[model samples]
Target chain A: MKIIARVLIILSAALLVVGATMAFASSASSGSGGIGPGRDGFERRPPAGAAEGSRPPGFLPGGAFGRGEGRGDHEGGRGMPAAFELLKNLVIIAVIIAISTLISRLTDGLRPQRR
Target chain B: MKPEHRTYIRARSNLLIDVATFIAFLIATAPRLSGIGIHEWLGIAFAAAIIVHLLLHWQWIVALSKTMLRKARASSRLGYLLNLALFIDVTLLTFTGLMISEVALPLFGLRLPRGFLWRGLHSTTSNIAVLLIGLHLALHWQWVLKTTARIFGLVRPTAKPRQEVSQ
Candidate 1:
């Protein structure tokens, strides 16, 4: 019962944040006359290959949802193979871990040594 | 449960939760590889996972909060601040994600207005979260290793590090 209460509190807090964001977004869009508060004027559109009605609602094949207009060319399927994309992300993470470890070590070294 | 046994169980749970959250983050980051559908759904699930993660460490969070501005060590204070920033960033990420949701929300019979600002913020926060996660993991890397070793029966139950509570 205690666990359940904690979960409920977290969920409620999250929902409150979500509600605030939605209200902000609604005002921003309204103020901009549907240009969507995008300084670059990028419009929100369905991805070109989404085939909205053709597939199951929330799950799509690799070729379908991640391609075309909604995002930049680099984020779509046209740029790289799936495996390569995953590899690239993993490599970024590896570099981040290395950098983080180095910073940690450097900080630890700065502290006075114990007798 | 014996105190040592209880500690072991907690350690195991933390390790599992951390690993799962990290994998989910990796997959969510590579939207093109996992497809936008999986990305959206996994991102929502990831939010839930994060809540659980925080709950697991709630006692520590409470303890640190009381002392963070008073007598907590510099590292603990730093970790707490970083965690606070991460929490705020994640809240923004989830909110922007929902605002620009393409798949998950639509499936639930709800559709938010198309906001290019929200989309931009979503992408930005997603990238920022990668760095925060890296730092978060780095801070807890020792705890992770020790817990894993204990779990595998390669190490005996021993004194935990002083800063482990911040983890």
Candidate 2:
């Protein structure tokens, strides 16, 4: 049982690492083309006539960034009010880290302390 | 009989179930890979795995919830919260996934009326859910390992319920 547990854990860890790296890499390479309401890459060129801070019309899937999308869109985009596309990636990274830490602490508590 | 062993068993079982489900999910989402027919079958398989996984963990879920309600410990509360988020995300992923129409599954004579909102929701939720799952694994990595070891019979189960099962 112990051996199986160890193997599963190792396998899961490997999967986790591979999965996350794949996701991050895909997101990075695919850029904004995959989904979300933002530019097509890491750096937005900002369409012609669009101001630095102002998002152009039709920039997002639906006109007016948070207007018609569901909570998933809101949460997925990190709920940045749609105006701050620059902060979108940052928000996602932060959320991942925060959730990871919280989960770690909780799971840690579930296990009995080792002597 | 040791606590570490118990912990290992529990964790390993959960991980095994999760991995199985993950594979199914990957198959289901394959259609997204090339907009092919293989995706529909995969989707069905994925959904089945989800049901199985849920059924397997039903007892733990009930116990976890009951414990949470009784004492409201910070850890238990956090687990419940994460569980809730995961549930919502997975539900949305499955829901939205089914919403998307595919040419591959047309032969099966099964269809769901396509909804633009559903498609949008599905894509967005899937992205978020993937991230959440990653975080979930990262947080529980240690337990995941301990359990895997036990499942493989490489280590004995913990004698007590409270002992460091793994370094």
Candidate 3:
């Protein structure tokens, strides 16, 4: 029973972290975050048909986000991305605790048997 | 070898690993501190080392948690809780680090959203975590110094350097 509990704890921790990443990844790809023909993941589409190089597309060229910086959302400091990041961070800490606990358990087996 | 010798060796080994992991963690977690891909891989390495560190101290942690519930000393309880918080913060650091990751996770094709929100949180939380760790170390400052001294063979040490007499 104890072993089962330990396994469950480890499993949950890994799942929490992995699940958050998957959710974030899906959300990103679902948006304009794809790599298609000279388009990096974070390209902010110009309004309908705006002239090239007319306005700064939120991110500076060779700036923070994946590809040069798309529109406003692609900027590293606003909207869904930030919100998602905060959410994912909560899961991240849980996952770390779980993994660390599991590892600690393994080390217990190696200790010199004490009376 | 005598049991005392074994104890000393074990203590020294744990200390060495702890110090090494800490140095690596500082390098890995520092944003853009090591120039590009270097920092990313170091982050992954930090994750691996952290688990090992926990494992090395598992016995004490387990013993303390059990005792804390039954009215163990306040200091011991504080140590357990402090360590717990540190580990959790570390997990957060790793998790958010991945989301806004420009290097490590990206190679595995794990592309997260484009925003500095995770990045910003990562920076802020890390700063807080570092401060907490400083306190944690301060609580154990004497032990750290003595252990380092013992490892260098400059001082003779007991199992705990200073064994606590039971009340």
Candidate 4:
């Protein structure tokens, strides 16, 4: 059991290091162009014929739903609907929990007899 | 108490930890399911509880190596192995959670990384962790029940609590 525990710990540490490295590399490469709260540098300006200052067809600005579209509302981008985005996030969280729980059970079942 | 008795007590304690962890997980995830911020708050509370839980079992961890070296008990060994994995999984989940841009709640003005990879990994690991936790619970169903009955005073010394209560 100790050996197994040690092995698992080592493996987990390695994975964490790898994950961190990958994340760092990606961030370094993508710079400010990554998808997130801040504006990506690579994001292009609205194309011709697109309503000036109007959020693109699907994209809703972060504060859109909370404050309602004000007079300054103009720039729009193509993005998932707010409701959809929220739902997607919720679904992802739920699925992750479900999977972890399942794996835990499988591991428990593999325990040897204690008596 | 005899060695067996001591073993039973430790096992029972471990079982209680599992149940608490499971409940915490449920509360933490429920908000996400309903698409509400409540889940995020609950998750933070859960994380705090988990930290406490780990601290409480620190001694067992210290003795883990000695115990494993002294005995060839398979079930006990396997339990330890699973626990080790669980520790890792939970740690990753917590870290990744802090990486996501979304704030369920902010702490001391601290914010999680808003990078693309952080978000992606956080999402992926979260799913895997959930499934693993479910399996952990199912595998320890007996321990869960035993600990639950003990907590509720449903476990009797001489007979099953249900029978004693009814009589």
Task: Output the number of the DockQ-best candidate.
Answer: 1
Ranking the candidates on lDDT from highest down gives 1, 3, 2, 4
Q: Mark the 10 consecutive residues where model 3 chain A has the least summed lDDT.
A: A33-42
Instruction: Give candidate 3 regions above 4 Å deviation.
Output: A1-115, B159-167
State model 2's lDDT.
0.52
What is each candidate's DockQ, to 2 decimals? Answer: 0.32, 0.06, 0.05, 0.10
Question: How well does candidate 1 score on lDDT at residue B8?
Answer: 79
Docking class of 4: incorrect
Off by over 4 Å in 2: A1-115, B1-13, B26-35, B103-105, B152-154, B161-167
lDDT of 2 by residue, A6-72 (tens): 4464345435644553355446545445222332112333466664345322134322234423222
For model 1, residues B6-124, the per-residue Cα lDDT tens digits are: 77787798899889988987888777667678988888888888998989898888899899889999888888988887887788888777766778988889866555566667878
lDDT tens digits, residue span A1-115, model 4: 8656655655566477657655665565565542332332113334567653554221244412232211111111123243443344345545655665676678779978698
Q: Report how far off residue B59 is in candidate 2 (Å).
A: 2.0
- Please provide, for model 3 over B30-105, each residue's C-alpha lDDT reduced to its tens digit, 9 standing for 90 to 100: 3333544766677667776776665566566667767878977876777778877776677766766666677777
List model 4 lDDT by residue over B1-167, tens digit each: 65544554655676666567656665454332333355455556665566656555555555665777676366557657776676666666565555442446354476543344444454555556665664555445555566567656796433322211110
Q: How much does each candidate deviate from the true structure in C-alpha RMSD?
A: 5.9, 14.6, 12.2, 10.4
Once fitted onto the true fold, the runs of candidate 4 whose alpha carbons sit more than 4 angstroms away are: A1-115, B1-20, B34-36, B69-72, B104-107, B111-113, B151-154, B158-167
Per-candidate TM-scores read 0.78, 0.51, 0.61, 0.52
User: In model 1, what lDDT does residue A70 have?
Assistant: 29
